[model samples]
Target: MSRPNPAVFIAFLVAVIVVLGSVTLAKGGFYLAKHEGDTLHLLQILFRMASGEWPHLDFMTPIGLLAFAPVVLFLNLGLGVGISILLSQVLLAFILLPAVFWAGMSRLPRRAAYLFGLSVLVLVMALVHGETERSVSISMHYNRWAWAVSYVVIVLAVLPPREIRNDVLDGLIIGVGLAFLALCKVTYFAAFLVPVVVGLLANGNTKALRGALASGLAVALIVSVFATLDFWVAYLNDLREVSASTVRPAPGFGLRTIVMAPAYLGASAVALGAIILLRQAGEMTLGLALLLLAPGFIYVTWQNFGNDPQWLMLLAVLLLVPEVRPELRNSFGWPLAQALGVAAAIAIAFAAPSMLNLAYSPFRHLSLDPADYQPILVRNPEHHDLQVREIRANRVDGVVALDVPGSGLEDRVGKAKRDEERVSFQGTPLPYCELQMGIVAWFEAIVTDLEQNGFAEGRRVFVADLFMGHWMFSSLDRLEHGAPWYYGGLPGIDSADYLLVPLCPTSLSVRKDILETIEESGIAVTEVRKAPLYWLYSFDRDG
Candidate 1:
């Protein structure tokens, strides 16, 4: 079959973007089903950037600048938050479109190229973060965006060009994709860099290697000049701080679980099976390169919140060779081509749920009833676009064990020692309770409670909890140098006026850790105000 026209593929991708973008915009806002805390964190970052603050400079975050820069660019142009976010994805797809086209056209067969382009575009434009969850959310949108970029880079590097080879062009794409991953989220860059380099070298793409290095260095130099040399140091510092955080080291599941857990074992086996089949088919270099790439794939999945295996779709495509020779057989006497085909099909099956969910999310958004949702940022009208379901926003839910003094279970157990480890602040033990939902209500009530008591304006509150988004809901000023979501250490503590300890904190362990760290630091805090919702303590650093 003749190769599909490159223009036709590019046009098809653009059309999909336009259709998805239009449908997303038709909603006039973004509605989230879950992950309100994460959405708030993203809001804080965008707000800080809009107010002339930079990540790792005026604020603390492990997320790289590029993650928010695209949205910030649209925001700077005076667009609403929802519109900015939507447009940013559209912009990202377009930005990465050239590389997508090149990789698809050069490396993949005609139909596969179309599918490849569509996959990248879907990842870029999808409203919800990847998962089988039908709910729509903008949380961790950057991760999806980063994965899209990774697809392009891996496709270009691992797969040899079937149609035409342009070493310089291929290298530039790989370099820019790597740099974008670095600037957007370093986890991807760190995970894929070695394997990508190895793949290029294994293929003897020497000119592409040189081109990649120069382009990567050039991009880094330009960023350094613009963002200043201190930016890199600050970025590294933020990453290091996050790395040490006991409150939240990894979002979900351990690295081992990601690779070996029952839920993930099938995908992992399929990946390994692909490697074995590739080698059996006399593609030793490709197989070896894939072997090196597997750990990185696992690492990225382990690092992400939902632990969705975003690499499977790409792996499925990678396994699809232009020609599958029937003569090749493995030691088991099975035809290598058919075995590879089965493996790729299994990979697709593993990936289909999330991929289908991602592709269908915008349509899901369109069907949502406006009456069912309310704005997350209650005070800011410009942010009226960011909304959550009223039930999720208004209804607070938590797990509270029946530990009544005369309860039969307690009597039977003779009082568990775990109860002895209750989190305490200022020598008073806090209730062992944690909030599982109603983040919007939590923030709104606290802000209102503070306002009612005249501790509202110009106060920098260091919330002793997992998330610090109270400032986003009210007139309260952000904790200078504070984290949107606490990673580790007492960030912005010295600059804080009050340490607000919630009655029902989001993460009890986080609250305990923060309070303990503060106590160890010897920062004197005196109880200033007590309410049903929280206890406010005035920081006395001088003492």
Candidate 2:
């Protein structure tokens, strides 16, 4: 038995680092900007968990709950977001490196194997870069990261080794890895299962097949039970609101879509052409071709078919090929084929990197200066002057509400008022109001925050809009009329204590009606200077 080449391992490690390092650096360029929803939400959950709070199921996406739980648990020792992301990326690279090395060793010569691994690394980097570039606005979405991680694991696990019996553990490990991937994103479950099923049928391993099937079913059962229970408990406690919303864009079978088939065919043809050229070189050359082609086929098919099982049929043709059989070892052509195969593999490996450099060039042109954006802590003098002073005086610890009024502020006020009207107009019909109120129903959040922070002792709470006062003051145990309403709601509508309401913009009837109701309800309304964007209204509930 030949000892494994240390060079192959070293090459694999270097490739993995290079791929991950480049992507991470590119992502870091946008660190000054706010992370997207997925990342923020994940970090929030992690923070809460680390602080000894139970992970809130409602706050997580279905698959995210599983993917985040371990990371949060591991990072509970006060690790920051940057450290957590780095750790995740490192784990992904380690998991991928072994598979690339094994796949190369099984099919190609040591040198060819190294080249094969290098090519895969380049392709993966290119794909990830493309995904990251497209996801700039939504960088916080953790699921994309989760999916990328799963893709790396799945490809490595599925690659066949040179000596199948020597690596019996690979299949079981793949099975367990697939289970975790399925838990994170159920769609990938098909990707692993289909290939396993095909391999079993081709090999005619009844006992092994039975075990794989049983294990898969057992995992599915356990996950489904847990998820169902979670949903029920979360919903009944009013901790989660479930709504069915979907985007079903019309399927386009355009010229571009048609063009994709030829591209894939061309890639496969090139890979096979390399294999034929390398035939005389050795069994390792053929094995390298099989390893690369197998995962690439699975990935391409899944991209097109949305993870259909029928696509596994393509692997059957691979099994039938004469060169794949163990008995045929060196029967194919030699020296000339080997040279051509090596040349082709090297060419294909360079393709992805060249394309990626072209794609990333545009982003590289932009300057990533933090000074371009305003600081979140900076006070807007026009709006925060009085409110900041008042907060300083009263020592309020929570968010200070502002009393700015403009079309933007009115939209929020109008939405709240309209939702309230819709609920009341319908005679307080339980479900009707519940469904129509949207997020506005959470008006109690302001008062809840205020009370929890002892804001009542200060006898005043800063607000962005006077309309927000309706919700805050109504919920307060006692109200103060002279208390200032801080202008904070819409940008450019900032005024301290003086409520700015823009009338040049058409008034939303809901805001107008709500204001009248507040006035009738004994909330004093003082109208001040009217600007093109907002009108000033001072409300003193204590009067």
Candidate 3:
């Protein structure tokens, strides 16, 4: 019965604050600063779910709907979109910061733990606060959560409990993590699952193996029951979107990783090489490093643009953990930790400049007047109708005859605009990027003109543009006659009577083949005409 150290307690609190505070403050750096903001359309999906419209069979998404748990709860609790996101972030930070702190404290001295935690936190923040090609403006939560939980799983697997109660709890934790990965995104699940299973097998821990197997099966069974109720065929079909390589760039490693992560790759290899070639293989550190890095290194090669440094920072820390224990501590491991830390620092330093520029670039934007950054609805009351170019008409006698252009999205939403427009709206809390805003404004004027001149929303309209499709869904979620547009959007474009297609930038961004197919569709084309930015077309199947 020894008394705890007061100094260590104070140090722990300070370390947690420093680590957590920095991450919290950095959220402002990019809470919604990107060109398109956080417009992955999760909130829209949640809105549909709250209103009793399930995706897959109702809508189509390559991303799993199970990822919307936070939003679903928020919607149920009646939280506004803004509040929901903030709460979501706060929840994530609360969970993530402690996990990071514990990992640092587990292996290192108190002072060293603080430093390790700070470094890892910064790396994670920087990774989230910017855009990567692979992430495509995703707020690094997906990557960070998966990494954080995977680290916890690794620690648990390496140090299983002796007590039955503790062992069961650990198994549950791993099970929930795997379940979250399964729902959040499949790639993340695969990333950890492959390495972890191999690591456990290599270690030959049969008890641990059985526990992990049971955990996975339990989660699978639960998900299976729900998916069966939700329509397994639709869920399976929705998965096809990830395989649409032509639509989005393929991620993961190759020769490019060699060029991108030379330092990290070289350093990781050397760490593994030291144990094997130098014959200090008591802890299987190199084997574990190999298992972790085998997939991770390649993934990082193309992860979030180039030089997967920030993520590498956390990965290096995780790989270094097993070697940091008092008994296991060796001549090889300490130096390896320091080397990986240096490598991470060096990598983060290189990648910081571009993202930093983007984050602060809104202030320096030259083209738009300051008024454009103000809330559009304040400037124009009809902005909802204007931005979307159509509204659902209200009819009392079962024949709604109001002249609303599109009825899907609300006027209060700034999410209607294009990516470029949203970027231009930087510093304004709106999600529309610069490109997106410009397109929205243009469509408002153009579509208003055409409708006034006699064009109208027919029984059905095909939104060829992906964002356009989302705009349509944010307003309405009709699935009665839906069919597959592609794989990522609501599956009902071909069933429509009229086709609304934007050319060049918007269409080009959707999918190359889709734009090409629309251009070659040979349907009745009403030339709403073209501009320098894009060509607007309205096609009629009846004609």
Candidate 4:
């Protein structure tokens, strides 16, 4: 029997995934606080987008508008995060897996179809499985979407299309792909130009290339004009904020991760050598592609070594396995290499559980502590770093604060049981469980104290990290004051009654800046609450 159509087969796979997701979500009660804030943020962005409020003018996402629209559209219509994720998976499955399936099934021997399918699963794991550094749920992280777009772009950039389409379909795909990437941090978007241009020539399909370029430009032009009319100042501010996000404390990521640069450079060089020695167009194109993707990938990794180097790793494995080629499929070497690839993919999938825990342990929204405010003590001489000592001293005075924005009351029925059930934390330790338990317990005690002390209803908090604040207190209004993007000042700072803050050491500078901003606004605030990891300040509206 002939092999199944690659697109048709992957479509079926995606359907299974969606069905599985639905079944898992139907069981309900899975909550990861790591996921909570993110869900709210996406909802916020989608709402804003629906209202014609694009980035810079108000809310923002690092990825381009194209990537967010479909998933956000599904979500804004009152669908749960499960459906959002399912839809995202479907979209990505269609956009990315099809290409991967095509690469294996079209080029390799017919018998190697299983290898292609297994390879795709391994790549998906790399794309969406691992727990992020900040206890973010795998489902919530933007990295998942980023990787989805990046994988397809990386693969397409290096490998020429096997067939150039005469219709607008390929152009639409390419255009939409590039447009989705357009809103990404500028440097990352720019890095793909070489490969895209090279692919244009290598494919020798002027129609597809011209169509792609035109469609991309048209999309960009429209977005730009809209931004210019809507909020050009906000758009300019957004560009500046993107630059500033990279301006954090130096040596942010580990040195071990940093070493990946030279390693990537070496790998690219070897691929280049292979291209020169082999003297084949396909080989040369791949080698060049590897060479081009290496620096960009390495740079981003160095900036933030999150998840899915395994995407590259999986691709590398596929590329390195020689016996999968049609002519060599029957050779003994073919079976051995193919087995090894399958084994490696299995090993990665197997390791994902521990990786999920070791990296970000399970957090459920179980009991909250209704504790009294606890005073903290710190001695400057005892600290090794001046920064730490200063931060501790400031913490004691309640000069800076971090608090989850909202009423400290959401762990009930969970947005109520059914709505909560709509999100499944698959990569989480609970495996589709909802309700954020304490991996490191969230400071719900702090929220409880503020609520008891009269800082509860109709109040807004300037969250140090929306992911944390929104999760703990989804009921409250939020102002994302923790990042530079919100530097322009909270819109209604004077009217707000409380300045909530994260009391953690990492928030010292954020707290300091936000406090300064509030002070400059001339609003009077009295430190009303302090607990481990949080600070609450009540405003004196009369003053």
Best by TM-score: 1
Instruction: State residue 51's C-alpha deviation in candidate 1, in Å.
Output: 1.4
Rank the candidate models, highest TM-score first: 1, 3, 4, 2
- Each prediction's total of clashing residue pairs, residues at least 3 apart in sequence or on different chains, is 0, 35, 33, 22
**lDDT by residue for model 1 (191-259), tens:** 999999998888888889899999998999998898788888999999998998777789899988998
Which window of ten consecutive residues has the lowest lDDT sum in model 4? 377-386
lDDT of 2 at 488: 17
lDDT tens string, model 2, 256-353?
Answer: 33324653444444445545544444444334544554454445334431221111212221222223322332444434433453445444443444
- The TM-scores of all predictions, comma-separated, are 0.96, 0.46, 0.64, 0.61
Off by over 4 Å in 2: 1-7, 18-57, 60-62, 69-74, 95-160, 204-244, 248-543
Q: What is the lDDT of residue 419 in candidate 2?
A: 45
Candidate 4 segments exceeding 4 Å error: 1-53, 60-63, 66-68, 91-136, 161-168, 184-188, 221-236, 246-256, 260-282, 305-308, 317-444, 463-475, 480-495, 502-506, 516-543
Compared with the true structure, what per-residue lDDT tens digits does model 3 show for residues 1-543?
122233564466455445444443332322232323124344346556667666676766555555565556665776554335434544554555544444443334344345445543333333243334322122434554454455555544543222222444445556666766666666566666766566556655555666767877787777668656555577666676546534544433444555446645554554444334222425464355455645554553444333343343433434333333234334655554444445435544544554343233323322223222322122233222111111111110111112234755455345433432222111222221123334334434434443444443333445444543233322223334243234344356565544444432343345434434555554454645444433345555563
Q: Judged by lDDT against the true structure, how good is candidate 1?
A: 0.87
